[model samples]
Target: MAVNQMKNRMQALGLLDRSFKAASDDDLGDALERLDDEHREALESFVDEVSVDGVRAGVRTGRIDGGMEAIAAIVTDAALADTIEQLGDHAESPSSEQLREVLPGVVERHRLGVTRIMLAGTVVGEAPASAIIRDLLKNDETLALPPAPEVEIAPLLDTSKRSSDEQAELRAKRKAAKAAKKDAERARRAQSAAARGR
Candidate 1:
């Protein structure tokens, strides 16, 4: 929960590409404006109580755990429920592509808890964000499907050189072979039935 540790967790959760060193007042104000009433209130309280210098001092003295308690309180089960509802409204079966499109907004809204759950790797039991992410990954895996094994149908049917009569002859031969095989199967079944009766 130290600043560095929190940063590491965020990175692991794909929440942060780079560490956040400092925020300008304008940057902070813009971030606050995006938050809901509860989260904004908690963040505002933290901002009110702690200055940049105060945070630096706290980090120096090892007093603050990166305001994790406040973050945890803000990102509650209710907040996660709201996120789930929002995601549901966004898509019925959220594809990875679709999720990626909307994920930034969702993460921006539920940053802390989503990061926490992603780091923990718990889906469904923890936050719905993790479950949503897991489902998207699963959908991606299903959709990938290994390109259908590159079936060599061209080799299987190389009739470009053959004449129409040759092709018709080949088709007739295949039909005859199929009929012969079916007759053999039927004969084998009749023999088996005779043996069973005896």
Candidate 2:
């Protein structure tokens, strides 16, 4: 039905069914007469494949639960839902540029997730938490994402924001480490001088 609606064609191929007690003589005759030899064989093959006893032969099958629920979750996210709707519009199906503009907002705002970079210009910043994203792009593979946005390539990635106190603390820690190292070096020089005098 989905394919039919998309392609504007009736699914005539779905008319055949073989599950029944038994067909009457008239019904059997009509079934044989309605379909051509090839179609009859095709229908027979389909029926045989679907038959529980026949289907289990020469084939392995496994059951999956929550498959549809997983699909539903992806479709339900605000950004994902919007993208699907945009794609469905057909007339104004967002172009590459639109997808680019849309994705950043979706990631930063709606998705509340950091992306590759936050540009303050000249100085490139943080990278993704996932090494997989970095490696994939590093190898110069065309990502299977929707399209390339008008993005600045120089900004490597976006990191979580740091407040003033956090920055100050980091600087203080670095300065303390440097002073400690310098004092250790001075002590080592004084000990050498004392040993040489002795």
Candidate 3:
């Protein structure tokens, strides 16, 4: 058989399994250190060959789509939150100008991907960043999470107005209602059973 066919036959028969072994971190490091200069240089070159676009594309694979407000929370503090509040209805979304002003600081500080910078600017400031922010936001390759979900809040109950006696009465009424419901259910079941028997 040809050498290629012979190697394929060996692989099919599991002989290739003996050619590789899992190594511990220390053992791998020692092996690398022991390599000759030429071999080490080749490995370094392979590492250096990774491109920014490749990294960015990899990050984009996990990108999530949502409103910008969450992005703002990650990159901004109380001052920025207050700034957003001051914008009133406009605060619902960040403007491009706000993004231009704030995104560089956010990107530099957080090491976020370009989409996050865009989101932070629009969500927190109600605008997208200018070219300045866009430029700064590019070339980043870090993985990022989706924004926080908006929570629905209910108004607090004012219990101070109710007297102790009234509170006790309310609890008693609730207990009575629950007992009545159980009695009514039992009666309904009894009627069904009687009808079936007849």
Candidate number of the best TM-score: 1
Candidate 1 lDDT by residue in tens digits, 1-198: 599766545533332111111223343333334557766555443333333443323223221333333332333334345444666765445545665665556556545324333223333223335555544433443211122234466557677999999999999999999999788767755653553354
lDDT of each: 0.43, 0.32, 0.38
Best by lDDT: 1
Candidate 3 structure quality by residue, lDDT tens digits, 14-132: 21111011112332233334445554443332222223332223223212221112212322233344445444465545454654455456445423333343333432232333233
Candidate 1 achieves a global lDDT of: 0.43
Candidate 3 TM-score over all chains jointly: 0.21
TM-score list, all predictions? 0.29, 0.20, 0.21
Candidate 3 colliding pairs, count: 11
Error (Å) of candidate 3 at residue 46 is 78
Off by over 4 Å in 3: 1-156
Query: What is the number of backbone collisions in each predicted candidate, taken in the order shown?
Result: 0, 4, 11
* Structural RMSD, model 3: 29.7
Q: How do these models rank on lDDT, best leading?
A: 1, 3, 2
